[model samples]
Target chain A: EAAVTQSPRNKVAVTGGKVTLSCNQTNNHNNMYWYRQDTGHGLRLIHYSYGAGSTEKGDIPDGYKASRPSQENFSLILELATPSQTSVYFCASGVRGPDTQYFGPGTRLLVL
Target chain B: GDKVKQSPSALSLQEGTNSALRCNFSIAATTVQWFLQNPRGSLINLFYLVPGTKENGRLKSAFDSKESYSTLHIRDAQLEDSGTYFCAAERNNNNAPRFGAGTKLSVKP
Candidate 1:
């Protein structure tokens, strides 16, 4: 079965601190995505990568950056963590087959 | 306008009853996928539709491209089925997918 795993299941960051959330997938999928889920919003895309060395900003890309170093690894970075950026982050991987996407357990982050 | 809208933001039902959740799209979509987020916060893929209906176990889903809407029907609702459900649609013009806000369902004994 295809699996997508995330590191630091739970994180707490101080204001202005830098935070990195890591994701690794064993599915060999070409597309990977980062999303944040809040209380009101369902899930908003922050960044997406089509392949290694490529990244595209999603609707809510502000305050966040993404990196795809290889087919199996994708990372989301928060340059300066803020209280507003505190939310659960999810990582997903999919192929262009227009098929279903596999999502990770999600990393819960709290910025103080 | 919101790209994707889900109806019945929250629903309450009794065990063994049935209910339906819906998603309406404003951005021309080519593919649709439904998911169930368990209490533990894991989103589980339920169905992937291409303008047609698909059924699995006690769940069924249909995506209508022309009407820009999708429906998920849960039959014989059980306590274990209570969770938040989401539908995401991928536009034909791009790889970007817009997701509905999600419907929270609660099943009572």
Candidate 2:
């Protein structure tokens, strides 16, 4: 069974619009991460949350923001969408340290 | 040199054959995790290694922190094993992992 679920399996937004991708996990995991997968590039971490109320910057977090208001939910927000940010986004949840991560079904986004 | 490099960006195998994928880490990785992203786009965890080897069904994995590398072996491959495989490793520094580009495997039955 998948421990994590992501919403808006597919989305399209105009440039400069606000876009948010939501994720929910039933695994009671202490860590959640958002990554973007683009062609020829490995999944780059956009942002991550240590737990409810704790959000941290990841490898590629300049144009993205993450929010974790509750233990079960994590949201990745792109305040001003751009074509460069268009990619497949994935959310993952896992235990505390050095634990295996479980990813949710990806969300494909297009910005024009 | 790349931080993490996986050999053979893609692979094709017969349904009942065997194959091995590899990951070489430039940084001092403390832990490694292997994942299989199915066609439907769900990344399933295959193995998590602190250093050593583990096996599940037809899949086997090995991690050597000293050598900074990991290997995943598939035995008696099946059509259902087709997908992209990824290796993510946590460096010894701040625990951030550098992921390999991935190896896309297509198993024909």
Candidate 3:
């Protein structure tokens, strides 16, 4: 099984605060993704990276940014957090082709 | 409109029963993947398919690319199977998979 880990399983941030969610994968997968899950919205992609130093916007990327400093690490940054941004975030890693993605436990964020 | 839509948003089943979840795609899906989100909020990969059917233990999943649909069948459902089931579709030219609204399942003893 591919190993994916996320830091700060739970977070509480104030409005306009800077929040960072980190993800690390040991499987050496080239593709990594960040997604947010809401009650009605299943899983909406925020950003993805094909490799190190590459970041691409997804369906919902307006208030989020991603950094892939290394192949094993991907981070999601919220420059100015808001209440609407409070949700569970998940990190996933996969290969470049039609391979299955392995997900991390996920981080729960609350912005007040 | 939803690119990938799942039927029966919620379901309740008794142990030792059988049930099936369906996903319909409006996009030209090339591949499909199913996942189960447990109570602890962890996504577990259930099956990945490419226009074919695959079975594992009491779980079976089938994908038909031509018809743009996928189905997941659970036989003899158990309490441990209670969770939210999600299906994702990968388009031909898109690298990102579009996910459907999950089906929340409750298995009772």
lDDT by residue for model 3 (B1-109), tens: 7999998899999999999999999999998999999998889999988899999999999999988899999999999999999999988767778899899999999
Residues A27-85, model 2: lDDT tens digits: 78988899999987878888888899999888889989889999999999999999999
lDDT tens per residue, model 1, B7-72: 999999999999999999998889999999999899999999999999999999999999999999
Worst 10 residues of 1 chain B by lDDT: B91-100
- Kindly report which residue stretches of model 1 are placed more than 4 angstroms away from their true locations once superposed: none
Better of 2 and 3 by DockQ: 3
How do the residues B8-53 of candidate 2 rate in per-residue lDDT, one tens digit apiece? 8999999999999999999889999999988987788899999999
lDDT (C-alpha) at residue A101 in model 1: 90
Task: Report i-RMS for every model.
Answer: 0.9, 1.5, 0.8
Model 2, stretches more than 4 Å misplaced? B92-96
A6 in model 3: Cα distance from truth in Å?
Answer: 0.7
| Minimal lDDT window, size 10, model 1 chain A | A93-102
State what share of the real interface contacts each candidate retains: 0.74, 0.68, 0.68
Model 1 vs. true fold: TM: 0.98
The alpha-carbon lDDT assigned to residue B83 of candidate 1 equals: 92
